[model samples]
Target: MLIGAVVLVLGSLFLVVPFLLGNTGVTGFVIGFIASLIPLTVVLLTVRLIDRWEPEPKRLLWFAFTWGAAVSIAGTLLIQPLFALAAPTSSEEAFTYFMATVQAPIVEEFTKSLGLLVLILAARKYFDGPVDGVVFAFTIAAGFAFTENILYFGREIASSNDPGTDLVRIFILRGVMSPFAHAVFTGTTGLIMGFAARKWHSGYAVLAFFIGLLPAMFLHNRWNSMGQNFLVEYFVVQVPIFLVAAVGIILLRVAEGKLTRQRLLEYARAGWFTPAEVEMLATSRGRRQAIRWASSRGRGRAMKSFIKGATALAFTRQRILSGRDVHVHQHDELELLRKIPTLRAAVLQ
Candidate 1:
């Protein structure tokens, strides 16, 4: 937590410096910053819905967002300029196109992905599966997009003769139309790392990160390359792809819920949880009903804790069954098992 706090502070410095030094006036900056929040809120609510089955730790989620908004953006700002210093002189238009299509995708996706790598390394236990990966990826990407949108919006507002018109146009294009652009790119990496977390060692998980980058970079490249035909291509190509990805994510979420139930059932057989308790813990409706019951008895908070612990316990059992890092998961399994009864007692009290 201390390390995360320090990183966030340093990243905040990186984030603020550009805005402070930019040509955008205070008014433009403030407007852009406020506008950026609209999309950020939308993206976060969507992530929350997807993560409803088993939420990642709040601290880790915050770290991921900070890493994207601050650290990843900082890295991109620092590194992309070096390419200009090294490149041969070219027409300004040509250079801009090259930077957008080639340089930006590679640098931004890679920097964004570093946050996932950090999570896999530092908080392996929570890095459970593809849904978790998508959640973290979307969060980090949302942060990056929020910062990027501010830059774009502020610059447009500052430079344009018609600030109001341009602001609305840009907001409609970016905030309304393509808010998930960054999330989709980085989510590819997160999804792969999530699969790696299930069965692979840390070394393999790292490799999976690189492997995932291929598709992420590809999609970003294609998106950037579509300059003139963006609207048509967006509707024809990107929309379909987004729909397919959404369907896949839905299936993965369903699978995760089923996996939770399956693992908890093992515990039920061993007398850790009653069959009814497993039913209550595994299903969304069951959980809501349980919480309502507990709330009536003034133990809503305790019920939530019990449900959370049981969910974590189910995943820990999954890690044990997978036969990778057994010792580590064994410790987690025992700890979760020990705490669960207490949580249940609290819920019932």
Candidate 2:
């Protein structure tokens, strides 16, 4: 019951960001939706291409987005109101300083990072490694940014009565310059959370938490600072950085995708995969071919199910080998595994 409540709370938080953005205006709403959705869809499809073996649960993905929206909204609302009162900005410079340097960096990063905390607390096992922490953090941060963009765009359209430069500027800033701004910000939190989840050291965990938060806050500050110089500002500063980050991100995913291959290799050395099954998940090329083999032979669904079941087998095997009983429903697990051969036979038919 408590777990269910937590999930519900997290989902509602994420749902609100898009809602807020849409309410901004038709033009801003449309532009913001297009800007964020296209990039995110590509990312998702790319993730599918790579991690074909064990897909993260769809429910968790939804929860991440929802968690970001809700937590961000609540955090900004709670914090910013106080900040505004504290700053007492009567001039543009003061207001700008208060907002860009102070309010935006702190509020956005913290709220966006809350999802990492939730992920750490709830499902530590699913986090494959450090890179996953970064990816998940980026996801929540982007979700928050997407919603924030909606609101900002809606206002731009409402005031100007057109989808103008302000909207484009936002695209450049949120979509371009700081593509990984929020990711970097919340990524720190994720690193800490990931480490903490794996280890049970409260003192070290607290230290990790602060260490992570510092870099995130600093990055947000620098990104916002870059915007202060209006004319000189361009993707020149960001493009190279983003490219480097992109390479790192790709390598991380590629490494993660090789988990099955690693597992297969471990036992392939001992003859678990019959050389054929081992070859299937060994490389990106091999994984694709395996999927295609399954799909072309008109066994797409069964292939997907088989691959998924096989992954479950792997993870269960891990737990069993570790002598863990947390998930020791062996009868149920075997029953599920037994269905795979039946499904495969149907595919063969």
Candidate 3:
């Protein structure tokens, strides 16, 4: 109820803000949408592919995106002006520095990370691990960045000079040069949030949240600060962050693969899964081959659904083993079980 109320208030503000600024135009929207979407597609695909074993629910994923674009952005718009008013600045440079390096990063990263927090609070089941948290983080960042780009483009369009040059420049900066900045920054928060979720009873969720928030803010600060040459910023600052994120994601993927393998073996031993099915489901390659074999017989959809259902069942059972609430998922567990026979019938033909 709280999340819904927040969303309602913020979404309304998000819709109304443009009209107040007189910046609502089709051209700006189009340009921003195209610019933001191209990179977002790549980010989404990369995130999804990384979590090959168990994909998150699409509805929840979309909610995270919407929360970022509407609620987070709305909060930022409302809070930032207050911050500007509160911040003491002797000159324009000081004001700019205050806004960019301090206020913006704190406000924006917290707001963006709030989307993941909402998910954790409202729908903990969707977030099983670090990969799921990263997925939500990237999606939320994408949505936030998309709306920001639109606002920037709109302002550029309203500029007195030729808007085309401004549009291209803004696109190159926001869309190309630093497309993943928000994602990378906020993903640090997501990583820690995932840890908090996994270890919810460890009496350290508060500590984890702050630990994540600090790095996110620091990274955002360094990126916003114009204290270095452009090439130095790119090579010295950006590349290492990107490599660290890449390495972290790869490590998480391997961990998830091992978890899947362990779960499948456990289920096979318990008679819930056949050894053949367990072996096939333990690896990405084997899963793909299973799908291909079913596709060759025109049962691709059924086989795919079956595989997904089996995977969910394994994860669900693991959750039960971990003493998480299982009653809420009773229906889902039964449904997946129901699909297994139909999936087999369709695929075995």
Candidate 4:
């Protein structure tokens, strides 16, 4: 079922691309789609590395990404045309301004943010932490961006009767610099969604999520408005805003990385993992490095089994840390998972 959903959503997004645009050369359209897709691929790899606790199925990941693209593309297509109706009689400036200032932000934010609600309501187990929330939201946003690039790129190609310039701009703006734009916009909702999931309160989730989304939309729209005036916007606004957003995202990831280590440390001290094992889980990079080091020595599968076992051990330790005795509440499943690390240690000798 999950696989079906992923395929269905992805297929639908592919169909939507050509329908939305009036004109586009096949080469430029393909370039635009591929250009937008590369970032989406890189970020998913990052998500997989970070989310060891309950890594979502690859199928579900695709479903989320595809859903974002399909829905957001449809939304902008349906609404933006209306704004074109409201286009100013005097100049193209009015049409561009209206789309930038009024239509795009509201539609795009809502469309991308639908993923938070979907994940929270439908797939409860996958909702682990802020990173998961961000990953989900970003995938959805990427999906939207992918379809959007196709439409806008396709139109530009058709209008100019030459796809060359359109391809270059798409590569720079949508492909390179702006992948973060949709992700950041929907992230405010993710922050709220994560809090709500942790609390297990539905009404609270909706309230908090939208509260975050509304502000995000405003910021997104503001950035778009300023940014359309490139010369003035770059020096006066865009660069500074980019720097701030970039720094903020870095801080959040750093804090998340720190907490992950701290949690493992606490678990290790409680005997959920050995002091040596906890050291490995402290950073995913370290864990991978250690695993590669082990595999080179011919213990590859055993090492992965060891990490999986360690994870179960870590979960048991977490339960213990949460409970009265720090030991009594842990059950049989945890015991079962702990054996892999034990086996790995035995092999190490």
Candidate 5:
């Protein structure tokens, strides 16, 4: 908690200093910040949906966001200039193109992915599977997009001759059309790291990070390289990619639900939970019905807590099976086991 507070404070400074330095006036900054939240909210809601099965720790989620919005963005800003210094004294247009297509994708994805690595190394117990990976990745991407949108919106508002017209145009383009671009790009890395977390040791998980960067960098490069024919490329290439990603996420969510049921069945065999309780805790419809039943008895919150604890128990079982860090997960397993019966009693009462 103390570390999270320190990161939040430092991240806030890193984010604010850039806008201040850019002379994005107070009006522009405020308007930009407000406009940015519209899409940020949408992105976060989508992430919440993906993460519904078993939520990651809130502190880690916040860390992912801050890393993207502040640390990753700051790293990109600092490194890209050094690349500029090394590049040949070429035409301005060519340099801009190179930076956009090459430098930004490489630098941005690397920095964004570093957040995932940090979580895997520092908080391995929570970083369980691919869905968790996508959740964290999407969160970090959301934060980055939020910050980037503010800068784009504020600069457009401040610099454009027709702020109203340009604001509408840019908002439609960035806010409505391509808000998930960053998430899609960085999610590749997160997905890979997540698989690594489940199957491999920490050292191999580090290797997985670089392997995942391949697709992330490629997708980012493709998106930025679309120049004059933005509409054509967007429809032909980007739309299909986004559709594929969405479908993949849906499939992963279903898999997560199934996995939760399967894991809890083991507990049922051990008498920690009944088979009926596993069914109630694992399925969407079952959970909803359980909640409604609990609410009718004025135990809605207790039911919710019971469901959450049971879900955590299932995932802790998963971590144990994976053999990544058995000793640590064993402790969590015992603790959850101890807590679950108390939570269940509250729901029954």
Candidate 6:
């Protein structure tokens, strides 16, 4: 409740204030939306696909994105300037470097990450493992990037003598090459939080956050500190980091697959699931087959929902077995249970 209220207030302020100030004209607004929409759509779809086996709630995903685009950006706007005022600088270039390398990494990463941490504190059940963490992290980063793109696109087009060429160039640089940069950084933190959520007690979640956050900040610093050759920085640093993040994501996916099978087996032992259902839940190919079978009877959505809810239920039960949460777990279990019967009947029919 508190988290939702905070996000609602901050997001409204950030979204409305610029418009009231006449900072963004329609042309700049249109350009920004077009510039961000393509990449945002692509990234969102990709992340959703990765999480297809066990989808997080759509509402929470939107909340993460909203928090990032509106709340986090607003908070960064207020906080970074304070650090600039406090620091001594030799030249504009030096100060620019200071803001980019030091202030940005600290402020932006924390701002982007705070949403996930809050969700972890407020609604830990959404996260079954690293994939959930990574998905939320990527969604929030995508939101931040979208809003930042809007502001940058608006400002650049408004200021430039040749808006056409400059806008295209900026779009190519930020939209194409660097779309996933923010996601990868904050995702590092999210991955650790997911691990803490899965394995360790709630008490360790904070320590896990720092462990993830430090790397995110360091990487953000490295990228920001690099000199003016965008291509050089991208190839030398950005690409490598992206590759590492990709490998990490793949590993997490594999881990989720294993965890799913293990959790389903526990359910099987409790007589809640069958071996066939366990196998279907465990493998991507089997899941596709199950979907196809359900679709033949016009119940694909129900089957999908059943699979997703069952996955969440399994993870929640796993967390309970580990001796952690109770009330949230019980609440989530009941909610999932209530919605799943119709789906189960559809699939069975």
* Tens-digit lDDT track of model 5 for 1-349: 4576466549666655665448566677888889999999999999988876578878889888888888788778778888787666679888888888989999999989988998888887788789989999999999888888888888887889999899889999999999899999999999999888888687868998999999999999999999899999999999999999999998988888898899999989988888899999999889999999999999999999999899888888888888867998899999999999899999987
What would the per-residue lDDT of candidate 6 be over residues 118-237, giving only the tens digit for each residue? 778777767756788899999999998888888777766777899889888888878888888888889989888887887655567777777889999998898777776877878987
Tell me the whole-model lDDT of each prediction, alpha carbons only. 0.86, 0.62, 0.76, 0.65, 0.88, 0.80
lDDT of 4 by residue, 29-72 (tens): 76556665676665556555545543556766776777777855
Candidate 2 displacement at residue 233 in angstroms: 6.2
Better of 3 and 4 by TM-score: 3
Q: How accurate is candidate 6 locally (lDDT)?
A: 0.80
Cα lDDT tens digits for candidate 1, 70-153:
888888877898877755467888888878888898899999998899888878878868888999999999999988888888
Tell how far residue 178 is off in model 2, in angstroms.
4.8
lDDT of 2 by residue, 1-349 (tens): 2477476666665656455654765665666666677545544454454344566566666667666656566667667877787774689788878788888888777776766666655665565345556657766766676666566656666666445877787667566555555665676676556555444344544465566777788767777776556446545654565576668667766765566566656655764455677566455676577779888987778766766665655554544454434455355357655775675566567
Q: What is the TM-score of candidate 4? A: 0.78
Models 1 onward score TM values of: 0.90, 0.78, 0.89, 0.78, 0.94, 0.89
Clashing pairs in 2: 13-69, 13-70, 14-66, 14-70, 21-150, 21-151, 24-154, 25-154
User: What TM value does model 2 have?
Assistant: 0.78
Please provide, for model 3 over 87-202, each residue's C-alpha lDDT reduced to its tens digit, 9 standing for 90 to 100. Answer: 76798888888999989999999888877776776677777567778888888887787677777776777662888898888878777777788889999998888877775543
Minimum summed lDDT over a 10-residue window in model 2 is located at: 317-326
Go through the candidates in order and give the C-alpha RMSD of each one to the true structure. Answer: 2.5, 4.1, 2.7, 4.5, 2.1, 2.7
Span of ten consecutive residues with least summed lDDT in model 6: 15-24
What residue pairs clash in candidate 5, if any at all?
A: none
The residue-level lDDT of candidate 6 at 113 comes to 91
TM-score of 3: 0.89
Q: Which runs in model 5 stand beyond 4 Å of their true positions?
A: 1-16, 19-23
What CA RMSD would candidate 1 show? 2.5
